[model samples]
Target: MNHSVDIVLPWVDEKEPGWRQRRIEYDQGKEIESTNIRFQCWDNLHLWFRSIEKCMPWINRIFLITCGHVPDFLNLDNPKLRFVRHDEYIPKEYLPTFNSNTIEMNIHRIKDLSENFILFSDDVFPLLPIEEEYYFKDDMVGDEAVENIISTGSFTKGLHEQRYAQVNNMFIINKYFKKREVQKKDWNKWYCEDYGDRLDRTRACVYWYDFPGFYDPHMANAMKKSTLARLWELEPDALDAGSRNKFRGASDVTQYLIRYWQICTGDFVPRRTQGKVFFPTIDTYKDVVDAINNKAYQMISFNENCTPDEFEIMKRDINASLEKLFPERSSFEK
Candidate 1:
């Protein structure tokens, strides 16, 4: 399998009037399942592109997934840029969806998407130069197959829904796979040294008869289109039910299911899956800025769950810091 990797980046312009109106209209009479922070813009998407052009230039194409709006700074003419609206690839029956899982799981239907591609969220940034081999090597996705369990006891009420989705994924994973069987085929792949201290989690869970759960790394995910297709083929009702979720619901299985599937099937190459994650708060503002400026992580995510006031301050300060690192316009921008 040739590893021609493309980047599937899903973005949303929540401030766009028409999209916002539709979102508002959709949310009426329903218990709010998500928050504005999940949809808020950082005014840093151009910087995201700049980081990509500067740090990861070998990408074959960047499919910018959007509901309808595209960033004004994007160079639509760039050969590596491909703007994909939700309706372009997602089936019509699943339209008007605000669920990221629905939009992502259906991405294999994109006619031009490469078989081997990486899924990037709008907020995930590549902080330093990265090689294509970092994402794909020897025709296997570079990822860790760490095992774990979801504990509602540890999560707050705000995060209970996320736990539910992970539990749902495990149900399907356990449906198709047995832990002893998967590990018996290859011990090293399941307990590789690349996982560092994290391998202990797998060892802890190994005593179980089946997969307990998988650690959902917050960084970008590498995947195979065929794997996505295979997952849907094996479990259409599950994927379709997830797609029909207009908002992320408790029953939904996220795109992480595909990654979990890959791990169980041993279709991935074990790699160090460590990456720095920051949830911006007033107390940690300086730390986030320092990490971004210093290039502390190869991959990083700024989980946007801070207070609006805090987010505004962090957004302003962080983008300013990023501007200093990527001072010039990348070919990605006009």
Candidate 2:
């Protein structure tokens, strides 16, 4: 299948005064005021772009979902690369109260557009090019490990309404099917006072129990354009317009939909793999380089330990495969 994957990242500029200081303060144990919160979201933006460059011969469109202030240095004229800003889709009235900008943008895009694409976060750095098989691998890690993590963490039982639903941050959705199913619901009243309390309770329970291990509650996931359009049809006002300007507080809305799906349909398949090879977070450039080297070593070790001759053959084959996959990247000077 010729899949169109849209890699999305929300970013903000650092030129604003005290931005660096704010990040440092927040990273430390200091009690910085929430009003003055500053995150270097662009750092991850650059990393994501670099990874895309390294794994080239781009398969689909790359969408940098932002709220206008994208740095000029990162600008490029690639036909496949697009920048979708929040103000374009969100209504001005509800922007202030919205907490999560990232989720809202995604929902807005899904609601307004009708394409099947993958959504990704800037924080996640792919060390090596991932083939289709790597994404849909068998023998996946299950809910058991996630359950163990929740049990050990600060989670309480019965706080949430549902069980057996786990959250994995990275996932792929067949948007065409998802959007078709969403049109039948009434989203305006979904979060009303009567339903809000119950939903909150359920979410709290899921967060405490099913978040870390089973799901990547923090990372991004993939879905189809049709699914988003249906969500928009159900609740054009579902996202708070004000929160779209920044990256924080958006996942809550995303989680709301995720939870709704869990209740409506009992399908929660893990999308990305979680193991030594796939690190969930990357804090620095060194981290990115290390991860790639590690994966290469692992591939080599697997072959060498079993058959030394095969080890050399595998290296040559892998290099050839990469070259074929990314011809432009040969000049990347790695």
Candidate 3:
């Protein structure tokens, strides 16, 4: 906890009108990421800042990455907030990108960013107070290194979607690291009790000398700028390809690739999986509400898949719950 940690929150206010036009103009053919559901605002972003300010007040700074459109409610005057535009950090060639992966892959380029940071999406919200160790310990980041096989469904469409990125990440990871050797070097770390049942998952796949895939936690990502730079040093072309992708393509490696490098290299401290994820379909709408009301997990993520009407209803309920929990205007608010 002696070292400082920052939160990198990349947001999209597509409702701003300019975002859609910019996206359409840039739509050379990236269909997978051009869905409305992908950019929907739940109108609960204020609660996210409130949760951070109240729960993790010791946070050093908040780098709010935007596409030149800041949220009206955000306190631009706040000393802790640093507004970042896509062109500011991302290289000029990767400009006008619609790919979230494209945006994320360049975060290490953000100036004055901490060596240790958590990548928080607009969908993830902390429900409880968290210490710095919750993300990092010593020089290692906190994570559970559970392995998994990419399901057949992942390649069904043959499009380079997120699952495609997972395969691409492992492809590069295996190229750099021999699984048998890494597991042998960090045997205890790989087989730690913190992984619980997932240890068996890794055990099941141990026979393979190469990694198939890392479990996609669908939660916040803890990362380091130096590790990112290391990956760039190791494989500049792979990263450059990812960055040049105006929209996420199958060949484009993700930020998860960096995390995989960290894990395979044993740069992570063991941590128990501590968050819950809800797919916001009508079937699970009630479950999301119950979790919030119960204070179920330390944090939660809503993977949007519901219909427009269903989301409107879910959005209203989510706002109600968060507003009730954090009634006062946080310092991050105007």
Candidate 4:
């Protein structure tokens, strides 16, 4: 029983030359404005790899997907790591993409990617010593904590439009499974039972939830390459909807589709852990401190929804915490 699993991280260097101009040009004529490009890298690649080496040294090959923006400090000579640019696997038509969704949709196409792999972002790091079983048990993926999918009420109210895409993707995914009718009913019922009093029943909109599973946070996400390939074969339209967008859009499918598809198809094994995995919204210094103090959290992530000033503050705090947590340089560092 081979339990080997690999790691894939989709990263970007926001300050890459011409990135701003390219993004501006790409934005011309799109129906929706995409904020996915607003993320800050903070040059944390070395720190993130160091965390992996410190906590999960047994991980197989690490694939860093980027737009040819390899970190200057990265040890390209490291045998266990590979740098994959968008031109390597993603179709040429979708090149020069700032859309994370487009990049995520094509990661499974990486050559020789392990059948079982864990997908994470550079902003996410393992908080404590983690075992292979933390992400995969008995060769099946599932262990990272999951949250309930938001249904009804303000899924589309935000100005940023990321959540709007999330909800729309969920609807498309359900429709593909032919579960739209029943899932819609279940969602309406759940919404009523949970928030019946707060809402105006007369004006409530019917929203669908991915009931069996919800989009987990930006922490490490486990995935099976074959399952993702199957998703592409089964729902090319959905995949295309996500891929064709130059940026994140309202109809774009999320990376969660891979996780949810695995759950829906019975390909996953629920995590055996007893306690919750802490992936806090990085709103303040306290949140980062709380995660640091709590060794129980196996993984953590810093989402990029804050103001530019706040982002700078959070990055300094997070990088400092990471430096303290993983002091020794990893072999992946130059």
The TM-score values for the models, in the order shown, are 0.96, 0.50, 0.96, 0.80
Which residue pairs does candidate 3 place in steric collision? 160-250
Residue 134, candidate 3: C-alpha displacement in angstroms: 1.4
Candidate models: Cα lDDT each: 0.85, 0.37, 0.84, 0.69
Query: Which clashing pairs does model 4 show?
Result: none
| Model 1: per-residue Cα lDDT over 229-311, one tens digit each | 99889989988988888887787888899898888898878888756888867888788789888889887888766777878
**Residue 284 displacement in candidate 4 (angstroms):** 2.3
Compare candidates 1 and 4 on lDDT and give the better one: 1
**Lowest lDDT 10-residue stretch of candidate 3:** 152-161
Descending-TM-score candidate ranking:
1, 3, 4, 2
- Candidate 1 pairs with clashing backbones: none
- Cα lDDT for residue 40, model 1? 73
Where model 1 places Cα greater than 4 Å from the true spot, the runs are 29-35, 154-158
| Candidate number with the higher lDDT (3 or 4) | 3
lDDT of 4 by residue, 1-334 (tens): 4467899988877787677678778778562435542555676789889889888888988998888877888988998998898999999887778788889888888998899898887767777888787678787776422335454454343334576666755665565554444434334432333333333331233243334335355567788998788878877886886688787776677778787666555555554332233333354555765675565477776555565666677677777777877889899988
Candidate 2: where are CA atoms >4 Å away? 17-38, 41-44, 96-98, 101-106, 110-114, 132-214, 217-220, 234-252, 255-289, 296-334
